[model samples]
Target: MVNSWWRRSARALAIALLLSFAAPALAADDAADEVGYQFSTDWTGPHTAVWLRHLARFMKKPDIHGLEIGCFEGRSSIWFMERIATHESSTMSCIDVFTDAIEARFDNNIEVAGFSDRMKKHKGYSQDVLRKLDYASFDFIYIDGCHLASCVLTDAVLAWDLLKPGGMIIFDDYVWALEKAKTQRPKVAIDAFMTVYANHIRVRERGYQVIIEKLAPRSDRELVGKPVVHSEEWEKDYEKKKKD
Candidate 1:
């Protein structure tokens, strides 16, 4: 068993060294350059590019593991694999509800990019697959499945379970405009999750996408899900703080 593990580890290291040379620099000349990838996808193109750059910092490190919810045309997934390729032990799992043309594009892009071995693709709604994932196993997770507040919150809560200490979670489309209801946006769900884990949450970026890091959780405590703050309580607390 020890020899087998060592051989596997050694093989992973060799693969990582080779991939490091193949991944591109996170920055793109233009947001539209996503077309340069096997599949083209953009949500706030310039911001997405910048967001990728921020992720680059964490991904460049060794032995990183990642999970992504929603692999539309494999755009962000491609970027992620590029960085993961740099580290031998790095691997990523992506969950997507594959149907119709998007399925082919996702498969083709990942295949053509030479990442078939480094990535594991899960075909299903993120909620179901997330339940089966090991706790605190991923170094990074990107949530982009459904834009609805309930769906986004569900993904965040579950992803929280899978994220490792000092791991990062990227919530895409935070400010995406869908109708006029603020509650309908990703920000609503992301903020609610933030309130639940306020002490452990570190905000990294807030714009078209929100990237935040999860600080190590204490062995003695647990977060019970959504924050306890209601509008009335929050206002009262804020007002009290101001008067004091």
Candidate 2:
């Protein structure tokens, strides 16, 4: 089991390394690359193409309703529109807190990609936009919002409420670092989310991007073999929240 963990880590690291070198080589005129220079953006990092491929495999069907928490320059949004939400009835919603030129670029990029009418753009912090959404209405959700531990955990819980049964939620930047080794960034929050919700969902893939499928209603036996982390401190926290 330890060897398996090491093997997955090694493979993830190798893919990360390869992404940096190969990102610039993706065909510019191809269908996937025609949506501006999103792939080249510094905010995208190296493993974007890999993430898109993963989304394709899991969300290949067209006409699905989707949500993206942080659209940034719309790289991942366009990827979803082009790859998975291709049917006329399909659409995606994006939420972001704008800064500088990113919002304008995000708009232009998705528009140029012919998704202007197909997407709903919400400008604000994720929490606000999420609150207005109908619960359990989304088929897929991609969360790349704030990196703070509490914020990420909040987004995860909210996304859980919005995700339909059998839907998938893809979390970006699971291992992001804010200040070398000082700040825990997204990992701490993601870890807490996984631990708290262990019985509610099934992990589909785990690496830089954590993907999980919300389980349909089932018997407790479904979670019989799943490992869980329990701590008295956490139990106290949970009880407090339950009372509130």
Candidate 3:
């Protein structure tokens, strides 16, 4: 038994290392690149193309629906539309507090990609826009909005309730360090969400992006195994500690 476990762990590690090195090369062949979507910047394409391309094979369906919190220049949005949401019935909704120029560019890019009719643009803050969206209506969601910890946490929690069972969510810039304080970044919030919701979702990848698939409904709070202590026991302990 011990030998089998060790062998399995070693094989998993080897596969992870191989993919880490090979993904960048594979991304070059992604079909989205051939569309020539107009972009003011290329922040997400290189890091996300390999995974998104892989997902397209399994996730592309006629009735697919996608949501994105940030759609800067429609780079990732176009990729999702052209690659993953390829069917005529497929649709994508994007939420971003857009400036006039940015919105114009995004509009033009989506038009060029022939997704203007199928795309829904929400011009507002994600927290507000997310609340208004229909629950469990999305099969795929990409979260790359405000990088602040608070915003990321809010998005994750709300988005969880909206994700259909077996649906996937991708949180971008997990290792970003532009902010001086560690508490201000997305990783902290992503870690907290993953820890609390560990029983509800299966983590698919953990790199620049944190990808997860919903295994159960968010309303299902059942833990998978025995917890260290029940809530009643924890409450009693807390009261005792306060007296001590």
Candidate 4:
């Protein structure tokens, strides 16, 4: 009788121990299903979602590097982190001046997005935080900071210098925002870069975004001394078509 009781007690203990370990594994699986390994954010609209899905497909290989500029509150940064975590070998680098460097033009938008506290947590977007990251070294770059033409241009140039050969660079907000001044927006800078670098760069599936692979070493050409004639013609034609 005592042997029977002992056997039952041992079985109960073994079952409890197995369950304790299994619970966490089950919970982790559930969490993975909830978020998958993809990057997601409340700010991701239809275009952005489609673009990210396409990017994920393009990056199916094992040894891609990534970089992100203007990591405001880490929504996109966290997405990159998730991607890196899932891959056995991948790295990302981020850059930003962080503290209203261009102008506090979007203060209300940032606040409304509920990123004020999150932004404060990361040393206000200094490159120092990125310098010591333990993950894989960056092979691709994303630029989304300082929408002013000069600032955007500067950031792109700096990122270009850091970008590896065959790596890709992504820019945010390539479309015009009516509320912001037309002259110095992010799209303006991207357009300027694309016009000169069109030979080496290609537009990604995302209409506003572009992807460039560093094929051969290249130099930054001076911004065209004159306004782009092609853009004016295209814009004029677009407006005319719209009116009709």
After superposition, which runs of candidate 2 have C-alpha atoms over 4 Å from their true positions? 1-62, 178-184, 217-244
Candidate 2 local lDDT, 1-244, one digit each (tens): 9999999999999977775555433323333354244434544445566556545654546558899998888877776776667677888999999776888778777766677999999999998889889877888888888877777888888888788888888888887775644244787777887888887778877888788888854345443235376799999999999999
Backbone N/Cα/C clashes per model:
0, 0, 0, 6
Instruction: Work out the TM-score per prediction.
Output: 0.72, 0.69, 0.74, 0.52
| lDDT of each residue in 139-169, candidate 1, tens digit only | 8898989788888999998998789888889
Task: Indicate the residue-level lDDT of 161 in model 3.
Answer: 77
Q: Which digits, one per residue and each the tens of the lDDT, describe model 4 over residues 115-214?
A: 3433323333423544444332446667776677777666665565565555567777777584788666877777787776665555554466656555
Clashing residue pairs for model 3: none
Clashing pairs in 2: none
| lDDT, candidate 4, at 64 | 57
Which candidate leads in TM-score?
3
Q: After superposition, how far is residue 151 of candidate 3 from its true place, in Å?
A: 0.3
Ranking by lDDT: 3, 1, 2, 4
- The parts of candidate 3 lying over 4 Å away from their true place are 1-37, 57-59, 218-244
Cα RMSD, each candidate: 13.4, 14.0, 14.6, 14.1
Report the number of backbone clashes for model 3. 0
Q: Return the lDDT, model 1, position 55.
A: 67
Could you give candidate 3's per-residue lDDT for residues 1-244 as a string of tens digits?
Answer: 9999999999999977875564323222343343554455677656656566436654557888889999877877877876787788989999999899999889877886677899999999999999999989988889999989999999998988778888888999888995558668899899998998887789988878888988985444433334455689899999999999
Root mean square deviation (Cα) for candidate 3: 14.6
Q: Candidate 3 lDDT (Cα, whole model)?
A: 0.80
